[model samples]
Target: MASQAFEEIAETFEFLDDWEDRYRHVIELGQELDALEEEFRVPATKVDGCASQVWLMPAVKGQGADAIFDFRGESDAMIVRGLVAVLQALYSGLTVREVLEVDAGAELGRLGLDEHLSSQRSNGVRSMVERIRRIAQETL
Candidate 1:
């Protein structure tokens, strides 16, 4: 259940014939994200198990399972920041329950990220997803 914004990215990935072009597109997506405020970059929001420093701040609206789930994230590395943006596109605007239900690996697989990313990057992505899932669960 990808969001419309994510679906658009996936479609663009499909149109891009080479991994280089897709990689550039991912970086471009990251550039579109608002800079995460320095105050929110504290340890409380920092995601563990990421090779690159990463922070994710939850922004839930309402309450319980129906609460809307959203987060702002940042990373020291450019590609990792893009990965955060991808995660944002994947999870933003979904309800907490919907966020919990997302098959992130499967959704990202559509973009061939699994094949393209390095082992460390893949682990970082997994860490980000786990953090997001935990946030959604806590919201519920």
Candidate 2:
């Protein structure tokens, strides 16, 4: 099932016709996210290929097909942090298979972010998704 968070974000983006307003909303979402603890911000959890320092920690609940993963992530950059929030909204509490199946890039495109973000930022988003998928694959 799609997360309520994802739906809410999409709706908010739709309601905000201006890209500037949407960007502000994304930044606000990042500001509202709970910060990851210092201990969890280790080299092991750090995401590569991002211009800004980013960390992701994953926790699995249940077993087999019933399993759902929860992710906590943080980034030094404001926009990057917002991107992390979006990823969390889309992927957290989803089964490993469901996480893999989600077309995150397409969703991002739908949000009109693909055209708005710099190439480096776009690549960073891809890197984050790759890291999440890798974690899911390893757990499976």
Candidate 3:
């Protein structure tokens, strides 16, 4: 089943006619995310290549085919935080194999975000995706 968070975000994006409005909605989504604990924000969990500081931690549950990976992330920048929220919506609760199978770049492009962000911001998002996919691969 699709995550309720992702569904709600996609629906909200579809309803917003303007890119500016969409950006605002994304920021709002960021605001809704809980802040990561101080200890979890350490360098070991930090994402490299992002223009802003970002930390992501993964929690795995169950075993074998029934396993699910949930993520918790935080970013210093508001927009980056929003991007983290988007990632969580799409990937959290998915199995490692399922996460590895997702075409995150294509999905971001479909959301019109790829065209709208600055190159740096886009690269930062890609870095986050790469890290998540790498973690998924390691789990497998």
TM-score of each: 0.98, 0.95, 0.93
Tell me the lDDT of candidate 3.
0.86
Which candidate number has the best lDDT? 1
- Across residues 1-140, which tens digit of lDDT does each residue of candidate 3 receive? 34566777888888899999999888888899999999999988999999999999988786654579788999999989999999899888888878877888777766789989999999999999898888887777
Which lDDT values do the candidates have, in the order given? 0.94, 0.87, 0.86
Ranked candidates (lDDT, high to low): 1, 2, 3
Report each candidate's C-alpha RMSD, comma-separated, in the order given: 0.6, 1.2, 1.5
TM-score of 3: 0.93
lDDT of 2: 0.87
What are the clashing pairs of model 3?
none
Best TM-score among the predictions, by candidate number: 1
Best-first order by TM-score: 1, 2, 3
User: Which runs in model 3 stand beyond 4 Å of their true positions?
Assistant: none
Across residues 36-112, which tens digit of lDDT does each residue of candidate 1 receive? 99999999999999999999999999999999999999998888889999999999999999999899999999999
Off by over 4 Å in 1: none
Error of 1 at 89 (Å): 0.3
